[model samples]
Target: MTSKKSITRRLTLLFVTASSVVLLALGFVIASSVGKHFEEQDMEVLTGKMALAGHTLEQLKSQNDLERITHLLDNSLVGHHGLEVLILRPNHEVIFATPNANFPIELVSVSAAQNSRRPITWTQGEQTFRGIAAELPTGISERSRVIVAVALDIAHHQAFMRSFLQTLWIFVAGAAALTGFLGWAAARRGLAPLRALREQAQVVTAQQLSHRLSVESAPVELAELAHSLNEMLARLEEAFHRLSDFSSDIAHELRTPVSNLMTQTQVALSRQRSADDYRSILESNSEEFEHMARMISDMLLLAKAENGLVVPTREAVDLAAEVLALFDYYDAVTEEKRLNLALEGNAEVSADRLMLRRALGNLLSNAVRHSAANTTVYVRISASLDAVSICMENTGDGIAQEYLERVFDRFFRVDPSRQRSSEGTGLGLAITKSIVLAHGGTISVESIDGTTTFTIILPRAP
Candidate 1:
């Protein structure tokens, strides 16, 4: 299993990593731009010095005087501090060289025909220099030529750049640290709503399910989550109440029969009785046992159905046949009440034959029991291309509107009184609904105008 991690840490890491990448890229671009600007400035300075040397050489051609050129070079070197000048003849002879100047021969060897001007960098001892070399015409003879070399000290520039880069990196590191700290703080602050939600959720218990998340107060990003959590709480509360009621109803239903069996047995045992009296008492106890058994059996069946253990056999079942069979079974009860049993419409559905019969029997039994005397208990089945609907409608003092929705709930009764009568174990409709649901169908009940209809709709067999 994957381990859980804190959302705050994840967000902090993301923010810090992104900021670091951006800062690093920006730092690189700025460093490169500054370096290029300094290099260009150095090249311009070197080019100007080369131009000055060429002008001084041009003035010497009119005199054809080497001494005059030497004097001018010395003066130029003295006037411009940190400047080096070297003058070479066409025969590779060094005509003039400034004090402490050691210009590279390679620079002097460069022919004007090959390249008019060339800039180069050279290091002497501990200092670095940038210089340019140009071959100039003497105007005295066709073979007479002068190579002028000029260089500027760039050691200070190098030192400044090194210091600038060190400082830039230091500032970049500081900025990254500051940004990461700020990002972590912002991430934590931004997720305060989620923290509140967690605290609220942690406090929730079964008894506190009625409490709901405050959607309106939540951030927009978390509103949907809050609403979903609230909805889940509502469902949990509803299920909890249903389970509580089911427990109470089960205990109430079982207690009566058990208490009666215990009382009757104790009374019968209290005094010696005739065999017939004892047999009668035993029969009464048997009846109570039978009721308890039926209730337990119904509860078991409902549990199986809910747990998806009721796998029904697929078979074509005739609805009318099932209705007629139930009518015959409940014939005595119906006749005593002077009720009429009517079967209308016809449809065949794919379902377990025994389950179908049981479902219809329950519906008919309920109809006959609740229905008024001389009223008709109508069983109707309608078929469509995809589904078949079975409606068991009865004319009687109909169920109240409030109880209609929960009529099929196990051990539920329209009369809240827990009196043990010939009515039922209060699981008849619940069993009917469970059976119908197992067959990929739905069962619903509605009452209106002294008429209640329980409708079962099942998918038609292909």
Candidate 2:
């Protein structure tokens, strides 16, 4: 909660402080210098008049005339001078004043005697004056009859400074506003290219992977950013292209082997042979063909998911039933691996039924293949109205912490030897992750010591 006045006040403080300091400093120096200069000049003129008056009195002593001194004094007070001259007798009698008006006589008498140093006093007219009094060196009056008073007016210099301050205020305010506006406008204009880049980035989709940031007509700094972004997009496009080609290549590689195995299995079943001979070949060939089919399908799905072609068809599904069904489907594999399978209580969720089933089947198969003999693998489902979570826990050699998150990446294998599971094809977890995400779910795996768990959480239907 800040007001505009506070903001404006803060901004003005620096200039205002500087201006006040400068103006006050100048005013002090000017007033001091002008007063000193005026005093010196006036003192010289007053001392000269005193000398002339003393000479006039000395000359008047030769003639012994009072009219001569009176006439000389009367003519001296004729014009409007910057300095006013007043003569007072020892009895405080006003003898003569230059441009005679009732200027306070005691002010002159008391101020001069009390403090001979220059006294700067202000009068009722709001004007500055300096006052001084000295005894005239005249020999005509023996009783020290005259106090020579000089008052210098200082209003013009004061008025000049006040007018300067008014003009300075206008200049400072106008400059601050003009500079602030120019700064704000320049900032907005300079950031225009970045705003354009953001708007263009909003429409970039996977299908339009070739789209790049525009560099033309951009500032040098923003142009560099544009070039870097374009390079990143090019790399991403290349990676996607290679992935698409690899998916096709994998399908071609597995389809021939699978087709031959399927054909041989069918031919053996069709011919008349002993049940055990046909059964052995049929089982061996069927397993090989089935493995090939599973690998091919997972690879295809991984490709489709990367291209964002798979959208989840969400519906309310009974998780307990789906687990039981997958258990039946892989019952032969589980028995062959010497592993026990178990399912937990019923859990209902909103998810893609087929995708969830495939993801579950992959997790179960991986768990079964990795687990030791006599160990149990559990498929558990927990649910509420808002969300459902499925966890498959198994007793297997757990993965390292570093490779846990990366296990869901396509074709990534933790085994440096690449010999632990050749039939895996490395796309199981990848496809599972893609499917879960399509249903607005998250999948993660955690392993500790010798237990690994793959957990999936999805939105549950009301």
**Local accuracy by lDDT, each model:** 0.83, 0.72
lDDT, model 2: 0.72
- Which number leads on lDDT? 1
Question: Measured by TM-score, how close is model 1 to the native structure?
Answer: 0.83
> lDDT for model 1, on a 0 to 1 scale?
0.83
Deviation (Å) of 426 in candidate 2: 3.3
lDDT of 2 by residue, 1-462 (tens): 874553344445554555556666766676667657755775676566655555555554422353456688667645646666666766787666666233567777776566464553547466576556655545655654456676667567567657755565555566556555654465556667878998887767889988888899678988998898889889898988877767665766576666878778688868688989888887877767677677778777877886779988878888899889988888898788788998887777877789889899889878887788888999888877788889999997688999997888776777756642354666888888988888878999999988999999887752
lDDT of 1 at 405: 85
Residue 246 lDDT in candidate 1: 70
TM-score of 2: 0.43
Error of 1 at 11 (Å): 3.2
